[model samples]
Target: MGLLFGSFLNVVIARVPAGESIVHPRSRCPRCGHQLAWYENIPVLSWLALRARCSSCGLPISWRYPLIELLTALLFLACQRRFGWTPELVAALVLVLLLVPLSFIDLEHWILPHELTWPGIAAGVVLSWPMGWGRVQDAIIGAVVGFLVFWGMEWLGEKIFKKEALGAGDKDLLALIGAFLTWKPLLAVIFLSSLQGAVVGSLLLLVRGRAGPAPDPEPGPESTPAPPVGPEPVDTGGEEKKAEDEEEEEDDWEPGPTSIPFGPWLSLAALEVMLLGPLLREVLPVPLDMLFAGAR
Candidate 1:
């Protein structure tokens, strides 16, 4: 089930960003538009059998396919071992399904589409109904608090620093996580995510000279015929100078060296709190254990 779901998630990760229908169009090779057969789409097994290349155009398939499949299988197995056959286990499975694609999508595109986060938030609330009304209330409060916290930070950052400190979709992702985990562990989630994101982001900046994955370069402007050569025009009333200054200001607003996506860190923290918090609390020192003790 995990392998199958992982295969489907690959579709979600690929299509959601492009505003494409994950269902209507069948999986096809991007290079040759070759529609895959049922046998060709059998998760990791198919990838291995095909030698990680498109049969039609011989385009090399990304290794991420099998990695995601295996990661999902292992995570599902871990959830089973932790929660057993219960409603909580079912909830865990759904959370994993949502988080896996969300994390990868943010890592790749640095955007979390509402198509996933909004539905995920609702699903988390609805799924908690079986646990109890108190849990449902907690989930609701958690979602509200989670969104407001980030929103506040965003507002403050813009007011003080005159720049965007958080991505537009980060609050929604955190709210979705809160809807699943409830309010009690939100502090721990924030702490763990910040700590881990800082460490990894610093390393990436040192190695790659940027904290986040670089965005794809947009195509340059189309070539045009050159105008007749003439003497350079003089600035008239300083208008051209003002225009150049404004352009420079706009360029200054672009992302800097330490701009990393926060969504992946948030997702990772949520998964850690859900799956490993208890074990961590048990093994760590008393002071440190308290940080991980707030799991739902």
Candidate 2:
């Protein structure tokens, strides 16, 4: 069932980015625009049978579809194993669904749509009552703390760097996740996310060479190129125009993709916290249980 659900999720993943309604239109091949038949749409099995190619166009499908389906299935099974049929199980499942979409979306676009995050927070808070796990107060406080702390970090980053440091969506994402788990596990999520980000970033840097600087935006087709630097009467002949251009370019440039799909990182962090954060609490040097017990 989870695998099947994940297949549908692939449609969501592809369509949501294009500002399309995920529920209205059915799935189709991107290359050929062929609407998939029910048989051809059967999650992992269909992918395997088709040999990861579209039935209509013979286009090689991305392996990500099957992988995501399989991953989601395993995640669902793991939650069921741990939590059984409790409301916590439902909450965990919701997290998995939302995270799957958010993770991939952020990876592709570096944006976490309010369409996901805001609704997630609302749903998380609403469902907390049925789960009877955390109090409403805790969820509210978590959201507040999560947003404010991250927003402060963003402000500080911008002030220091003289550039926007974090996307507004990132702050919203933290708030949304924190609303569900409250402050304690949210902290765990942030810590784990930071650790993961650093490790992944370092590995990528190593693999891809020191990150290349961002490219300048491509000029529109109709735009004309500026003439090469020539003798402009400047402050003095002592100041070389060529040297000034180089310095200006260096100062003005921003790094390319300093933003990794942070939504995905946050999603993974939330997943870890949801599943095993309390266990980690037991192992922490300072007893996190003592700190969060009152909040619970």
Candidate 3:
């Protein structure tokens, strides 16, 4: 089941940002446009059997495909081990479903599409209904508080630094986490995500001179900007086209050499809190107990 869901997640990650229907196109090779057969789409097994190449075009498939399938399977297994056969396990797995794709999308595009986060926030709250009104209330408060906290930081950072400090999508993602885990552990979530992201970002900056993943190549000529060396595109469309282009440039914020996506870190911290909370609490000192105040 995990593998099956993970396969679907790959489609979600690929199509959601592009505003494409995940269902309509069916699985196909991007290079060759060869639609995959049922047998050719069997998660990791299919990848292995094909030797990581597209059968039609012989183009090497990306390693990310098999990795996502295995990663999702392991996370599902961990959730079961942590929560057992319980209602809470269902919530945990759903949270996993949300986080994996968001993390990958942020890593690639530096954007977390609202298509996923907003719906995920609702799912988190809805999933808590089975636990009674108190938990539901907590989930609601968690979502609100989670969003407001990041929003306040974003506001303050702009006033102080005169630059954007956080992505707008971050608040939504945190709200999603809060709905699932409640507001009690939000401070810890923030602390853990920041600490881990900082440590990793610094190492990446030192080793590779950039803290973010390299951007994927955009398909088609329109996706790439015109080179300055090339003849300028005709201005026959007048000022409207220029204004639209400027608007696009203003909306898109490309990461600098040191910029790192926080979504993946947040997802990692959420998974750590959910799966390893008990072990962490037992091993951590008394001073850290406040961090896990909401641990089950």
Candidate 4:
């Protein structure tokens, strides 16, 4: 079942980014544009058979496809083992898969698209009813509070820092999580996720060096400059200016970098709560306990 779902997840990962339906469009090789046949799509078996290369183009397919499939399968099986054949286990597995896609998307593209986050919020709420995890009232309250808390923090952070701090996608993600975990754990998720984000973001900035002067100032009427005064000013002059631009671009690409995916951190927090939050409440140290006593 996990392998099968991973196959479907591949379809989702590939097509969702291109604005294509994961159901309607067949899977194709990005390198060669060859539509994969059914046999070629058979999860791990196909990857092993093809030797991790596209059949037609011989382009090396990313090992990540099979790895993700196998990883999700193991996670699903592990959740089942831990929680057994229960609605809670199923819901937990769903959250895991959703987080997998969300984490990878953010990692690769630095984005958490609405295709995942908004639908996830709705799915979490709808599925919660069927799973009997919480009442509709609880889920609804979770959604509202979850969104507003993050939104409020975002407003405050901008005022204090004079820069956009939280990504909007993160708010949507918390709202989705709140739909499943309810209002209580939302606070835990926020506290832990922010701590994780600060530590990880600082490391990434130290490594990536602040991403090219904050990315051209987010395009506004004021930020958008008037057209050049005269002709385009071609490079008829010195090699020095061109060399400077190349040096700047190279500096942007330098390595020794780290960027943590916050979705994974958020997912880990939610999973911890799902797995052992109750247990921890009984055993946590006084200082940590004091901070989240209201959650208890």
Q: Which candidate leads the pack in lDDT?
A: 3
Among these predicted structures, which one has the highest TM-score?
3
Over 4 Å off in model 2, which ranges?
A: 210-258, 282-296
> How high a TM-score does candidate 3 get?
0.89
Clashes found in each candidate (C-alpha, N, C closer than 3 A): 0, 0, 0, 0
Per-residue lDDT tens digits for candidate 4, residues 1-296, read 89888878877776676688878757888888999999999989999999999999999989879988997898788778767887667677888778777776665644568888888888777777865544556777888888898789779866764433455677788888887777777777767765766565555545654311132223333543222111112222232222222222221322112233456667767766666666667788877665445342
Model 2 clash tally, residue pairs: 0
lDDT of all predictions: 0.80, 0.69, 0.83, 0.66
Off by over 4 Å in 4: 131-134, 200-261, 278-283, 289-296
State model 2's lDDT.
0.69
lDDT of 4 at 51: 95
In the range 152-205, model 3's lDDT, one tens digit per residue, is: 988986676545678889999999999999998888788899888877776775
Give the poorly placed runs of model 1, Cα more than 4 Å off.
218-255
Per-model TM-score on C-alpha atoms: 0.87, 0.80, 0.89, 0.74
lDDT by residue (tens digit), candidate 2, 181-225: 777666667767777865675456456532222223443344333
